[model samples]
Structures are given as C-alpha cells and as structure tokens.
Target: MSEESGSLNTTAAVGEKINAISDGSQIISAGRAISALVSEYVQESYCYRWLTKEPDPDVIVIDLRETYAFGPFITLLDQLVPHIEDAWQHSRVGAAAERVFKRLVEDVFAPLSETRGYELAAAMLAPPEPPERRNATVDDSESTEDELS
Candidate 1:
C-alpha cells in the first residue's frame, strides 16, 4: 500500500480502536463531510454531492455558533461560496445552510461594520424574513440591487 493510503487505513483503525474502548461506540463525524460540503456542493455551482450524501437533511446543517469553524466558514462564505439558488429551491439541506450564511453576516462579519459586510448582511437578512426563513440568493446581479433599495 502507498504511504498515504496506509496512513489513512492506520488512522481509521485507530479511530475504530478508540471508539471500541470508549463507554459507547459511536461514530464521530469527520472533516471529510465538511470538506465535501465545501469542495463539491457549496463551492461548485453544479454539484449536489453534499446533499445527496448526507442521509439526514440535518446532517448538513452547519452550526454557525461553532466558534472554531466560524472563521474559516465565514471566510468561505464571504469570499468563495456562490449561492446556488436553484439548489436552495430544491434541497432542504441547501435551504438550511442559509442560517450559517446569515449568521456569518449578522454576527461575525457584521461586527467588523465594513461597508461590504453591511451590504452583505442587508442582502442576507432582507425583506424582514422571520428567523426560520432567509433569502437564499447571493447573486450580485441587479435583481439583488433592486431588493436592496
């Protein structure tokens, strides 16, 4: 076996061992799911791999409240993630991701109080939607401009 493959096998074996030794054997969520969310679905407009793979819709819900993942996730939301409106319309998982994006604006980036952050937050929190609902489009097109004013 190649070094990386062998290492990953060793790691999985170690994880299995640890779980077996613990009081209750429970599978922990891995960063691979998060990575898939980032790489395949969130960042790739044409992809729905994240949604298809997460058996439970809630599996994909990112807790924006997580302080550790907050910075990196916010950076991705602010810079790289393209809002896939069609996916939002289709998948509940896609719709649920809105909370993370909204919190990115209202809580973290909004504190910075930059013009861009304010604009993004306004766009995110637009139309006085209730806490359960948020606008899913992050398109910077004129349609968004119309909604802003």
Candidate 2:
C-alpha cells in the first residue's frame, strides 16, 4: 500500500465508541482500539495520567483513556483541523472529539522543549510588572483637636 493508503488504514483501523449521558453529554467508555492505534502510530506516547478537560463548549469530557495517540502524530493537526471542523459542525460528539484532538496535540504530540522548567518559569516571570502607585489622600481630617486649635 502507498504511504497515504497506509496512513488511512491506520486511522480507519483505530476506533472509539462514546457513551452519551442522559443529560446530553458524552464520555468515552472503551478505548482499547484507540490504545492499539496509539501504540502502533504514536512513538514515545504514554498512557494518559488523568481525565483531561476541554476548555470550550462545555458539553462533554474526554476520557484520557484514548489520548495517548497524540505523542507523535500531532503535526497532522494543522491538516486535521479542517476535517475536525467539518466533523464537529455535523455533530456534537465530533465537536468534543475536536477538543480532544487539540488537547492531545498540545500536551503530547508537540515536540519536546529543550528549555528547562526553570527557563519556562523565568519567561513567565520576565514580564515587567506595573509600578505600584502611592495613595495620596486619606479621609481622617475630622479630628476634634484640629477644630479646637
């Protein structure tokens, strides 16, 4: 098979089934198929440590059970975004999947940083803070002594 065909097969072979709760919400229940795909295609990816939350469209939660596939294939997301948007626009579940896709790309699939944790911390703190201003006036001018004087 051509490389393109192979990739298509790899993606198609992977599968997931999401269960929607009665409150019109969904969560992943089984992920072995997805895990197998990650093991096959995602180098250096590891099992998700916890359940991760998507920051938008608060209708669903991603079960980290299947996100380990992001370790290497995240670069594809730029291309995948169009597909994700198309899929999501068609279904709420797909919308949730798009968020999951983004999280995986951000947390695992992106290249490892050479900078140390301290470097990141320093960068965050590097921004200059606004200088503190002195408060000029107080309302304590009502002393009886001033009146007597």
Candidate 3:
C-alpha cells in the first residue's frame, strides 16, 4: 500500500483499538450532540455529507429529539453567546486581534464555560431559512420610491 494509505490504516486501527478498550455503552448527552453538530457545521456547511446520507425526515427528528433527551441545551448556550461574539468580533479587527480572539476562545470561553461552549457551538450549526421574495418582478422604468416611502 502507499505510505499515506498505510498511515490512515494505522490510525484507524489505533482508533478501533481505543474504542474496543473503552466501554461500549456510551452516555449520549445533549451537550455532546450539540458540540458534534456544531463541529460538522463548521467543518462543512448546512448541507453536510452526513445530512445528505441520512435525508429521512424521521431520522432528522430523532436526532433533534436526542438534543432534549439529556436536558435543555439552552442554559449552556445562553452562557456561551457573549464570549463567542466577542471572540468573533475581535478576529475581524486585525491580525493581533485574531490571535487574541483565538486565545480567548480556546482559553477563556471554551474552558471556563461548558454550558455556553455547547450553546455557542450549537448556534453555529443553525441553518439559514430561504429569503421571501415577491411573485411579481419590479419595473425599472418606474420610480415609485417616494410613494413607497
């Protein structure tokens, strides 16, 4: 096999070994599910390969319901929004700001606040709805700006 293929196989084998050693029964928590969803959202888009693979409406509902199985992921989310917004805002400022933002997210926001961490992560996964448009096309020849105003 090629070197890269061999390395991937080795990694997979190691991961399997680790899983085998750990207890097979894992507690699926809302925070964990939300975190995973957020990760997938950030990694891809709303139209992720996993979503396409499992397009059944029932399955999607089941997955969403799993979020509530453990508890409301809301309280945790409420704590996370401000820190994340701050970090994101910082990144937009400059290179130094970006570094500071990354540090803040990694050290302060993520570590210090678990509930907020999951909340912020979940928000990132939310998909945008389609914008509403009028059925009729606007006429460029007419100026109705004053009338509309």
| Model 2 Cα lDDT, one tens digit per residue, 37-92 | 77675554343322333446766867544477763455576579899788768998
Clashing pairs in 3: 76-115, 77-119, 80-116
Residue-level lDDT of model 3, residues 1-149, one tens digit each, is 69999999999999999777564535535556789988977768655665667557765334443466544566566688888887767675656777888999999888666787677877888775434322222432234664676
Query: What would the TM-scores of all predictions be?
Result: 0.19, 0.18, 0.19
* Residue 40, model 3, lDDT: 79
Instruction: Estimate, for each residue in 15-126, the C-alpha lDDT of model 1 and write its tens digit.
Output: 9898676635233344555677778656566455565555775557666746686877776776644555555667878667877789888987777777786779878978
Task: Please report, in order, the local distance difference test score of every candidate based on alpha carbons.
Answer: 0.69, 0.60, 0.68
Task: State the local distance difference test value for candidate 1.
Answer: 0.69
List where candidate 2 sits over 4 angstroms from the true fold.
1-100, 106-126, 133-149
Roughly what TM-score does model 2 have, to 2 decimal places? 0.18
Prediction RMSDs, each to the true structure? 25.3, 31.1, 21.2
